[model samples]
Target chain A: EKSSNIENYFRESRLEEFLKLTKVTNSYGIFTAHHLNDHIETFLMKITRGSGLQGMEGIKEFIELNGLKIYRPLIQIPKHILLKFCYKNNILPNYDYTNNSNAYSRNRIRNNIIPEFEKINPNFLESINRITKIISQINNKEKIRLFNEFEKLEPNYEENNISFSRIIFNDLPEFDKKLILKNNSEKLSSGTFMENKHLDYIIEKSYSKSNNFSLDLPGPIKLIATKKRITIEKLFEIDFQ
Target chain B: EKSSNIENYFRESRLEEFLKLTKVTNSYGIFTAHHLNDHIETFLMKITRGSGLQGMEGIKEFIELNGLKIYRPLIQIPKHILLKFCYKNNILPNYDYTNNSNAYSRNRIRNNIIPEFEKINPNFLESINRITKIISQINNKEKIRLFNEFEKLEPNYEENNISFSRIIFNDLPEFDKKLILKNNSEKLSSGTFMENKHLDYIIEKSYSKSNNFSLDLPGPIKLIATKKRITIEKLFEIDFQ
Candidate 1:
């Protein structure tokens, strides 16, 4: 039942459909076992495709998708370790056949990739695991401080849109300013991260205008730059509600 | 020593530097992470940058980075969990201060973004997590299978480069073709994973019966495409010894 739904989730929803139905059973959050291998792949994908800071972040441990809380605890572990664990435990896990064919970009990583590191340094995986943990810890602290500040800085949302005062945002710590923009934008659309260029455009636009201005995102979110603040709103007929 | 090295690694290497190093690693059958968040980020970043399918892939968990290994394990995590964990643990994590400053495009995701779904369904994170985990597992299994197959279809690398035989790659799988391209083009000087536009240009150039074929990546990697073979070489001084 789960696998079928999982396959359908990919083929059908484009990741948003599931976002609509899930409910945070309590004040609870979601979780996953992400590890160093995952982080390297993500970084490669983003940088290879010409991504900015967010892409460079390795892997995020948590995010808000549609009101649900998502989390990853195993990001520090290596797949080999997990494989080793499974082997030691006599757990014969399911192997996806498609990975062997390399029809997908990711399969190339598992099949045609990953082994060369064992040759370069037997402990490469362990080293990366350590590095990622440090990175994760540092990033975690920053996230908390930023989120606290974000909760305090209320974005003025009017007429189904939200914005922040340019003057107020400028007064904030540079870090806070960026956090405000990211979190506030999410209020408009879930599961979306803008690019460095686009964020630059937004910042550039935000400073020059007081009138209503907007940037289009993947979801039904619009980033509106206003005279007093920046607001995000859902366009007409695209009721996220 | 390790802590200092880790910090130095972070300081000395920017995203671009890592990309340069990883390309060389790819030739040796390394893999990087290409998970859910990465997929999402890649998809968004590509659209913003107006890139192609390759760009949409973001980072992959297992990639051949010039024979080095790069992996990601946290792509399945949601941002909120990282945030909450830091908050609850009082971790005081480090953040990309620029993210809060709105200096880049991704700040939008960090700030005024993706919060509405919380107000609506409340389980958005859980839903995306579910999908990400399922897909990630499938990807993992596929990776192992593909690796075994790759070992069987190994092309003899002459002069530390694979002979460019479309027949050798075409029959394996589409993903294998990408892997072969990735493998041969490891090292910034080897011309692997260059721009999609440049890839097409190279392919177009390939159609012509030109014995002297050459392509340059952003850095020192150069590809001299011959009528019957593609020679991969580093155009810059690399410390292999």
Candidate 2:
């Protein structure tokens, strides 16, 4: 795994540990204190990495994975507020030294980029929170609309494969088309989301004059565009062998 | 004028000068050397200022104002490429000394924020340009759709005032609702756009239990929401007096 993916790796490992602990303790769910500052830093990081609207929703408050509920109740509360609360309650919060090491992009954003934004607007975090709230609301509506359009296409799903009419797909709006491709690709790949470039490649090939074309997506997914239809299928190790 | 608006002031002054020069020289239009780097800087600035999707489109490549067309032919080209071409041609480009001043947010973003982004991705500018292109395409389609929705309401327009059914307006999607308010506010105010807070205030009040309410927008526009309809009117000096 790359250094950049270390954060995700740790997060997954921690969640797995939490799941095991939860089952042993018979707990209802897990709560992590990811605050507003962390949320804003993530938002900035996503923008720098060139994420689409779907990626700009910032951190979600609630998520459920493998029958375990994950909640971030402090997402709306700023870090300073949380720290003050801790101090008032005589609670000693652990300060991870790695956060100040600047070894990670998130640290760089927190130490460098956020201060610059604060110089522009003292309430930058709150402002970003408001904007992202609106964005998430819009994303929710768009998600429903996109699902409706995808369902209207009468897509056929067989095991790890999904297929839909090429003409109907082509006629959809560019945003919806890209989203539908993303949604289906994620579904077929068991939650592996394709990058914008991969989706763009599939869309471009699908619209090309050629009658048939095949491309490999990041999830080891196979996308075949024929004269009448487009199909995406996840490839397993057996198929590769 | 506030110090923050100095850039807009200079831009408008420059455009006026360009219009005068164009008429005198019998030129068709004006071309400005705003390259990809500048575009990315503006994008970062907008994000820091908590802009919505519409504001994330960055800079426009072309603008037609008062019968004089303004073009940014270098918008797609990177500043380094332009500098290299100028060096090869033995043409000296003037470097604005003020650009290095951290007093301006744009300068801070260009000097501080962007280098950090480069550390994350070597081709960050190109990535940003691609994302913004997709965003602009989506914005264009959304603009047309929003206009169609606005027209479906069959709004009444007279002089500097426009009115539509409150129930119909309330029924539109959140994104479309905000955008329609923006579009109409700009139209009534002769291109002055209201901030998100003002639009949110209007929307919130419109949905309140009160049967009748009135509020002032940034453009000095008056928004009056009644039981059956909502009206927005630009207030002139005479009306204010």
Query: Judged by lDDT, which candidate is best?
Result: 2
Q: What is the DockQ of each candidate?
A: 0.02, 0.49
TM-score of 1: 0.40
Tens digits of lDDT, candidate 2, B192-219: 5578677788788777788999987654
Give each prediction's root-mean-square deviation over alpha carbons.
Answer: 24.3, 4.9
Weakest ten-residue segment in model 2 chain A by summed lDDT: A1-10
Q: For candidate 2, what's the RMSD? A: 4.9
Best candidate, DockQ-wise?
A: 2
TM-score for chain B in model 1: 0.54
lDDT of 1 by residue, B26-137 (tens): 5433233334544454443333444323333445555544434455665565556666788999988665452232134443332322233233234544443433343344
lDDT (C-alpha, whole model) for all candidates: 0.51, 0.76
